[model samples]
Each structure stands twice: as C-alpha cells, then as structure tokens.
Target: MKISNETKIGVLTAFAITIMILGFNFLKGKTLFGTSHTMYAKYTNVQGLATSNPVMINGLQVGTVYSITTDKNMKEILVNMTLTKDVNIPVNSYATIKNNPLGTTTVEIRLGDAMQYLPKDDTIRTETSAGILDAAVQEIRPVLGQVKNAVKSLDSVLMTVNSVVDPNAKNNIRGILENLNKTTAGLTESSASLNTLLNTQTGALAKSLNNVSSFTGNLANNNDKLTAVMTNLDKTTTNLSNLDLQKTLTTLDATVTELKASLGKLNTTNGTAGMLLNDPKLYNNLAATANKINVLLDDIKTNPKRYISFSVFGKKNKSEPLKYPLPDTLNAPYIILQK
Candidate 1:
C-alpha cells in the first residue's frame, strides 16, 4: 500500500500523543495494563504529600497518591489514592503520610485484618504524623528556650562584670602578674634552699626512720603479749559488766531516800532530835539547872558541915568533910554526871 505524506503525519501525531499519555501515567506510577481501584481518605494536613507519591503497603509499592482536594469548608483535605486491584484494603484500613530521615514524604496504607473490605472510592481512615524536622524542632524548642535564657543571664553577668571592672584593670593585672613572678622566683630560691637542707639531713632522717621502723618491728614481735593484755582487759570489763550494778544503784538510791526521810523527820517538832534542836524552853531549863548546880557547889564549898558529916569513935566529927563509900567503878576524883 502506498501511503501519502498527510496520512504519515497524521499517524505520527497520534503516536506521539499516545506516547505522551503513557509517559505521563508512568511518571504518576500508574500501570496502563493493570486494574486499579480508587480509595479516598480525609486528612487535616497533608504534610507535603503530592500526586505521584508512592503509596506503600507492607513496604511494597501498590499505589500512588492520585489527587488532593479541600472540602467545602477547607478545613479537611481529601486525598485520593489509586491502588492496584490486587491490593485489598480492609474496611478499617488507615492511610498515613510518613516522613523519612532523608527529607522525603511517602504515603503508607496500613492494611487491617477486618473481614470486610472497603469498596472502591470509599473513604478510609487518615492520620498525619510530623516530619522528622518538625519533630526535631518540637523537641528542641524548650531546650532552645533554656539556652536563650542562659545566654541572657550570661550576658547580664558579663555586663555587670564589665561595669565593676576598673579602667586600670589591665595595669593592675600586669602588676599582679609581676608580683606573682617575683613570688615565684622567691619560692624557687626557698625551694632550692629547702632541697639543700633536706639533702644535708637525709642521712639523719633515714636513720630516724629506720629506728622508727625497728621500733614498730619490735612492737609487732610483741603482738602476742598485746593480745594477752587485751584479753585480760576484756575479762576485767566482762567481770565489771557481770556485777549487779543496777541492784547496787537501786540500794544506794533507797539509802539516800531513807536518809532524806530521816532528815525530814528530824526537822519536825515531834521528834526528840527536833526538840533538842528547836526547843528554847529546854535550853533555858538546862541553863537554869546548871546555874543552880553551880550555886549549890559554891555553898557546899563555903559550908562544909552542911553537906558532910564525920563520926570518929562513935562521936560526931565536924572538922573534916564526910566521904561516902564509892563504887569500884568510880576510881576518878571528877564527878560523873549521867543524863
């Protein structure tokens, strides 16, 4: 068959249009020969979800996001996913947009285990998750706020320090450094002298240390005696502990209580001791009796015949004072007064 140029151009134009359509559908992840179903989901935010983005189920690519549209109120976004017919979406399946760490977004349809499958063009559940950067920003917000506050505090402290610093601070610091250098030099000299002194005394110091070590060795050798002494101390302490100290304390307390009670009784006016202590009349009577005895003694001394009589050869003798027979117990010349 002989074809004309007009027919050839017409065929070429049609072929080109078909190839463009196929290429467009291929780019949109659509299989021209495969059967697919449309599923709908409503989302509040798409989070950079776009058409031609791969829809995955169990990490397998089964569909692509077909279109995104807003509802009448523009409050919710309607997302249409064109999934292959072989991919069965359950009634309660959910479509979620996931973000990768590489800063790319993907749609994932999580298949549920419901026996009922969703009809074509039916709206499934939708959920939105924050992107990696979004989540990172969210987590870092408080830390950044704290860092900002710390920065402000540091700035204020630095301002205060700057204000408090003298204009001659540099000169003062230099002077201080110079003084420090001098001090360091003096310390170096002192250290050298001390090192020399230490060198001179090293032998004596070593000898003293050796003596101390020998003393310690001797002590260590007598450890058995020390142990025995400690054992004796323990036994003494045990014996002291075993004594009835509590009973002794109780007895002492009782004695003290009785003594206090006796003292209290002695202070009362009814007791003999109290009468001796507190009675003025008894004291006066005792004084008067002593005075009368003194007068009697004086009278007896002046008139010997009034108190004494002597008989010599059956006749009365008044020249000498009479003497009564004394008991054997009364050997002394002094009179013994009994109460």
Candidate 2:
C-alpha cells in the first residue's frame, strides 16, 4: 500500500479536529455523543468563561456552555447552555459561575426545587450575582483611612495626659490632705446640722409616719370588706343577669330612641324651644335688649352717679340716699359698696 503525502496531511488534520471536538464536549460536562437541550443565561461579565465550559452540579457532569456571545446593545454577555435532556430544572432555577477558592473556575446551575419539575429548553434568569473579589478590595481604602486617624487621635490624647500627670508638677500631699480634712470637718458639721433639723421635725415626721401606718393598716383590715363588696357586686350582676336582660335592653333602646325623638322635636320649628331658636323675632328682641343695655351702660359711663350712687352716712354724707326702684331685668344678686 502506497499513500501520498497529501493524503497523509488530510488524514492528520481530520484526526486532530475529531480530538479537539471531543475534548471540547468533555470540558462542557457532556458525553461527546449525547443529545442536550438549550437554555440561556446572561452575566454582567464573562469572567474568563467561554464556549464549551462544563456546567456541573456536585462535581457531576450535566451540561455544557454551547456558546458565549456579547449582546449587540453592549449590556451583558449572554451564555447559551446545552443541558442533558434528563436534567429537570424548575422555573426558579438559576445559573452561577463558581471558582474554587484556589483553582480553576466553572459554571453551575442550581436546581431550585426537586419536588417541582422543569420542562426542557427553559431559559433561566440571572437576577442575582456573587460579586467579584475586586469589589471587596475597593472597600479596604476607607477602612484603612479610619484606622490611621484613630491612631493619630490616640497619640494626641497620650501627649495631653503626659503633661497633666508629670511627676514634678504633682502637688504636695500634706497640703492636699489638710484641705481635705477641713472639707471633711465642714461636711461633718453640715451633717450634724441636718441631724438637728431631723430632730426639730421629729414629732411631725413621726405623726406623718403614723398616719401612713394607719392608712396601710386600714387597707389591710378592709381587704375582707373589699372582697365582700366585690362578692356583692358579682351577686348583683348575677341577679341582673337572671332578670330579662334582652327585654331590658330592648326597653332601654326604645327609651333612648324616644329621648332622641323628643330632643329632635325640641330642635324642630314646631316646638317652643325651636321657636326660640329659629325665630327671627326672638333674635330681634334680643338685639333690642342688648342695644338698650349698651345705651344704659353708656349713660352710666357719661354720668356715673345716676346709675351707681355711693353714700357714707356715718363719716361723709351723713344722710341716707334715695333707693331707686329695682328693674325686673336688672335683678342681679348682690351690690357691694366700697369705702
């Protein structure tokens, strides 16, 4: 058998392409020959993830990322996932990329509830994301700044305390003790004066304490009386309950209704109170009376002696003044005379 060089190159290329395709399918967590259904998820960033990436659950191969494409609107990277036909996903299922704390990263889909079945070829929404480590690294700056300021404040406080508590600047102990003794003597005298005050008010304090004790004793002694009153109240309530409560309530309702009707009648134009309330003639009479009173007050203001007369018989006037006849409208209770 004689093979040409051109045929050998073509065979090698075809074998290489087969191996590459199989390797890609294996990396995507799929059997190279198995059938899969498609789903889609969008990520803010692809995070070095690419086509043919394996989608796994609990380290088991389930599916593969079929393709990764940037949105034409330039918002997100959309990932098309081709999962095994048997992998049932709930509608609430989500896909997330997980990196090993120390190793290569991969994508995983979390099946929401095993109880509920997911139909094939369902698109899962990526509503939440586990943020990148870069975001947390950005926060270290402000925290470090605060730590620096706290250290500076501590240093300033130490400096102030050092000046205040200098060994050479500390005052003499005996002088301080002497002043303290004088203060204690004054306090003792004040305490003695306060004790004397208590002695002076002792009888009143004792009487007040006795009154409090008597009140407490009365409360203690009347507990049975209070209990008996409560018992009587309960008996009265039971007796009232034994009466025709429904009929009594009905009567009360009727009486209240009648009272309301009577009150309404009082306010209506037909009744006497109603006439007084609604009548224009009554208001006109009131206005006339007010005007007359205003005029009388004005007259008294002009000539005080005519309306208000003061006479001192013993010391000044030496004669009784004539008493004016009291008017029915001006029947006030009392009139006080001033010296």
Candidate 3:
C-alpha cells in the first residue's frame, strides 16, 4: 500500500514532536525510562534556584531540582528534587543552595551518619552558602571605610601645614641664621686675639704680682719695728701731754702783767724813766749837747794841727780854719750818733 504525502508529513511531524518531548524531559533531568527518589525541602528564599539546576554530592552529579513552588500558606518556598535511586540519603541530611563563581546556582546534599535512611518524600533541612564574590565584598567593606577616613585626615593635615608656613617666616629665619653665623665667626676671631694678648702679657702680669707679694712680705717682716716706732711715738705724745704747759703759761702771764704795769708807770712820769719820757726840756738840752759834741768832733777831724802840736821838730803845719755848722732851729728828738 502506498502512503499519501499528507499522511507521510503527518507521521514525520508526529515523530519530530515525540523527539522534542523526550529531549525536553532529558534537559529537565527527568529519567522517563528509569525510576528516581523524590525529596522535598522548604526555604524562605530560593536565591534564583530553578528547575533543572544540578544537585550534587561530593562533586558528583546525582540529581537535579524537579520543581519549585510556593507552599499552601504562601509564606515559604518549597523545592522538590529528583535524586538517583542509587543515591541513598540519611534521614538527618541537609539540602543547601549555593552560588558559584560563574553566578550559577546549584543544590548540594550533605549526607549524615545515621543508620536510618530518609523516606522518598520526606523534607530535608535547608541552608544557604556565600559565594566567593560575596565573601570578598564582605571582608573588604570595613577596610574600605577606614581607608577613606585616613585619606580625609591626611588632606586636613596638609591644609594646616600650608596655612602655618609662609615665605616671610622662612626669610626671617634665614636672616637670623645668617646673623648668628656672623656673630659666631666674630667670637672665634676674638678668642684667638684674646689668647695671644694673654700669652704676651702673662710674664709681665706675673712679675707685677710677684713685686706686690714681695712688698707685702717686706711690710710683714718690718711689723715689729713699726710697732716699736709707734710705741715710741705714743710714749713721746704721753710725756708731752704730762708736761706742765699750764705752769709755763702762768709764768708768761705774770711777766706780761709786770711789764704792762711798768709801762703804765713810765707813761705816768713818776720815775726816772717816766721823767725821761715826760720832760721835753731835758730832751732839748740833751739834743743841744749832742749837736755841740758832733760839731767839735767834726772840727778836730778837719784841722788836727790847730788842736794838737807835734814836738818832734817843734814845727806846726799850716792848714785851713775849721768852721762849725749851725744847728737847725726846729726842735727835734735826741738821737745819738754812735761810732
């Protein structure tokens, strides 16, 4: 029998549809030809878990997630997994969802050591694990904040330093340092000159000091003689002080009193001395007699042959006559001319 073209197309289409169905089931990890153990787990969050995500045990692919749905209460997510019949799990095992470095999600079944096996439809305990990126981000978060604070503090310190330091202050400091250097140099030069001057004067200064010392030593050595001289002077002063200066002064006073009394009596014209002082006529007679005697003596000096003759030859020498000077008419006091 020959088949129609429509029938042949229908049969090919049916076969293609069957192949697509099997392929879809294979991709969903459903073993249509074999049997598997189904298990359940509940979680608050799924973290992008989906059907057909692989389930593993010890890095071995043992099953896949079969379905995920909300529970009847709508409060928790419920996950159903289809495990291989050969992979038996303990009753106390956990189902943990984990994210990989590639950002894909998977479920890992951690087996427990209990002798009793988990029933096929029982719920497993659920957990979640952090990815590499998440753990790294968590570790670096605090350190990033601290580094930001340190950078801000360093910027503030730089601003303070910029405000405090100025060009004028730097110039003033430089000038001060220059002056100090000049002063130090002057002091160094002067120190050498002073040392030279001291060296030159050292011997003279020492000799002068030695002379002073010797003078003082001489004074010290003559201290006893000085004491003796002072003692003699003290004794002379004491003896002079003990002398009767009052008695001598009294004798002098008595003699002066007697002389004054005699002077008074003579001035009164009561004695010969008084008569001589008071009598003007006697004084005139004495004055006339003195004038006569003076004239006679003068005549004798001029004409000696008239007054005396030499008898040796009984001859007289002729000479000029002696003339007497007339006495002055004014009365003057008697003043004797002494030879």
TM-score of each: 0.39, 0.36, 0.38
> Could you give candidate 3's per-residue lDDT for residues 1-339 as a string of tens digits?
999999999999999999999888778877878987788988887878899999988888898888899957878998988886577788878888887757568898899988888877889887766666778888999999999999999999999977987999878889999999999999999988777555635755566777899999999999999999999999999999999999999999999999999999989778899999998988888878776666666667666777897787866767655455335422333465899
Q: Model 1: runs farther than 4 Å from truth?
A: 71-74, 133-339
lDDT of 2 by residue, 1-339 (tens): 999999999999999999998887677655667776777888887667777777776678677788888857868888888777566677777788875556555677777874776566666866444445755666776888899999999999999987787555555555688899999999999988777656635655566777899999998999999899999999999998799989988999999999999889878888888888878899888766665665565455555665456765523323333333235434332333798
Checking candidate 3 for backbone clashes, the offending pairs are: none
RMSD of 1: 18.5
Taken over the whole model, the C-alpha lDDT of each candidate is 0.80, 0.73, 0.82
lDDT ranking of the models: 3, 1, 2
lDDT of 1: 0.80
Highest lDDT: give the candidate number: 3
RMSD of each: 18.5, 31.2, 28.9
Q: Write the per-residue lDDT of candidate 1 for residues 1-339, one digit (tens) a residue.
A: 999999999999999999999989767766788788788888888888898888888888888888889968879898888886476678878888997756556888888889998887788888777777889999999999999999999999999988988869967988999999999999999988777655645655566777899999999999999999999999999999999999999999999999999888778777899888878889888766655555555556656556675744454435543243234212233355898
**By the TM-score metric, which is better: model 2 or model 3?**
3
